[model samples]
Target: MLKSTFLSVACCLFIGHHAFTQCIAGGSNAVAPYASNSSNKGVMFDITATNTVTISCFDANLPALSVGGYEVYFKTGTYVGFETNAASWTLLGSEGSLLSIGLNLATPISVPVNKTILAGQTYAFYITASNPILSTGVLTTTNSGYSAITSNSDLTVYGGAGITYPFGTVTANRAFNGTVHYILGDPLPVEFLDFTAVKVDQSVLLEWETESEHHSDYFEVERSLNGIDWNRLLTVKGAGESSVKEIYQKMDDNPLDGISYYRLNQYDFDGTKTSLKTISFNNKVEIGENDIRIFPNPIIDRFRVFGNQSELETLKVFNSVGEDISGSLTMTCHEGFTDVVFKDQVEGVFILKSKTNSQILIKK
Candidate 1:
């Protein structure tokens, strides 16, 4: 009876060991019949500022899959690198346990992954089997497993002036077999704070101030005939600072025939650039005829004119005491408007006259 009992105990131990090995082998080499060699089995995700995305599993049997240990990679043109393990992937929803056979059969598992991309940059995500034995059946063979996927997630990333990315993609195996995709976004607009044009006798002076700059590389002064097909007049460097005020100036002496439109081209420090608000003025100077009308007669600071002409050859103004006062006034012709500012003249009645025209003014 003692011999029989010992023999029974030994047989039981052998059976238990065999069962354990079978379970491990089955789970590890279970012939992922659905394993796909096609590159399409991968997925890509695009994220921008102020957005979020969720990744989930389709198989109900694959729970507690090893997602934490998987590696992530990114491709930006000729540059390629791996993402830092810090916060690279987040586990969302519920966490399940390992299957009895060492396989993960948790299905419908959800994981939310999010990240903000800078303007002109590209990004994506990837996953690999962490433990061959434990993750055997974690991935599926169906379209849900072998196919690539993407989500509508966006995060906001701030970029300096003129910074942009031309090409980017996400790779699964870091080879041509990985998925390829494109990213989309628009740069923030440029703000022009104070824009003014002063018309002096011989030229039109343009001046403007900026309250803030975004991706500002430089600025180009553009002129247009009918508000279309503009020609570049001048290029000004941009101040690449956010929320900081900047000042700029330009001059256009060669006036147009009709209404002239002027605009600012705000280029970022990078190659990218955008246009600012456009200002228009009419250049009406009669080369042979003069019909000039000066406004703001009680002139305290500046004055303007309404006329039908092409140019102003000369202008003269005298105080009641016959003292020359025109020296203080600076005149410019824009389209059909003339801008004049008095800086040195004193308060008194004055006589104003152009080459072919004359008028009386009272300054108080």
Candidate 2:
């Protein structure tokens, strides 16, 4: 249907349970009347954080950005380097006019980029509009000097503007005007509490629970023999908006042989769809849970037999500070179970991972 999700915040599926901070970057506005041009030249930034982060609200200053909003385009690498690089530009999506900071009007709302940025990656964006903003910076042929606006510890601002919509070539450095905001592992789609797919005879039963939902429309169930190619099984209606836990179920009557993956995707009312999560269910399945789980979530120091133990080779523990302290754990092997003892004085949230399964252990 050609649903344009390129630049809409609807593409953002927030699943983050912790860590949120906002930061602002400085910029220079037009001194004189800017000549009206229908192209986009936007702020550029680089991620320096060690971990991957989700950036939602990044405000780009579009001078004379009028009643009609702007359509934003994005590209990786530097603007000047993309001339013959053959890496085509991407349609980043759009922002509402009410969210834009212009017309010396009412306070503008924050617009979201909703992009998950990896460490050490650089990005640049250009805007296109029907009633283009009137600014001298809109149509600059030469390098207007570099606009280095580094703000938060996560994002460092860089500068580059292009010719017009579908812009490629760049002269030197362009003025970067905007704000950069990011969150450490912030995920917000339909807050999925848990998604599980079970084998029931020849058919597979898919059931999921959501903690909360916002602007949600419907759910699409897809099956993939391999994790790559997917086919839609059916569509289940959504709750639209809800605060309490919402339960949804879909059954796949014709189950595939061996192991097949079931993926759940949620679409907003506007048609922006995001994959919630994927689970692998084997036709020949075990009666118990797919993954061996951990229990007695809140544990103290010393001997804490919180969860069930299975023979695992890959076992690692990470503390709340994102430090790997897997070596500190002392494991006591018994006949049927293993008693996992923690080091004394170690507290806070810890992640215990074995193979594909991870259990969150909170020290109280």
lDDT of 2 by residue, 110-188 (tens): 3334455577766555544423452222332223465544545555555544443223344454444444456666455
lDDT for each residue of candidate 1 in 97-166, tens digit (9 for 90 to 100): 2232113322221211212245445444333322334422223222332122222234321110100111
Best by lDDT: 2
Please give the distance, in angstroms, between residue 282's alpha carbon in candidate 1 and its true position after superposition. 0.3
lDDT of each: 0.40, 0.49
RMSD of each: 34.3, 18.7
C-alpha lDDT of residue 178 in model 2: 43
Best by TM-score: 2
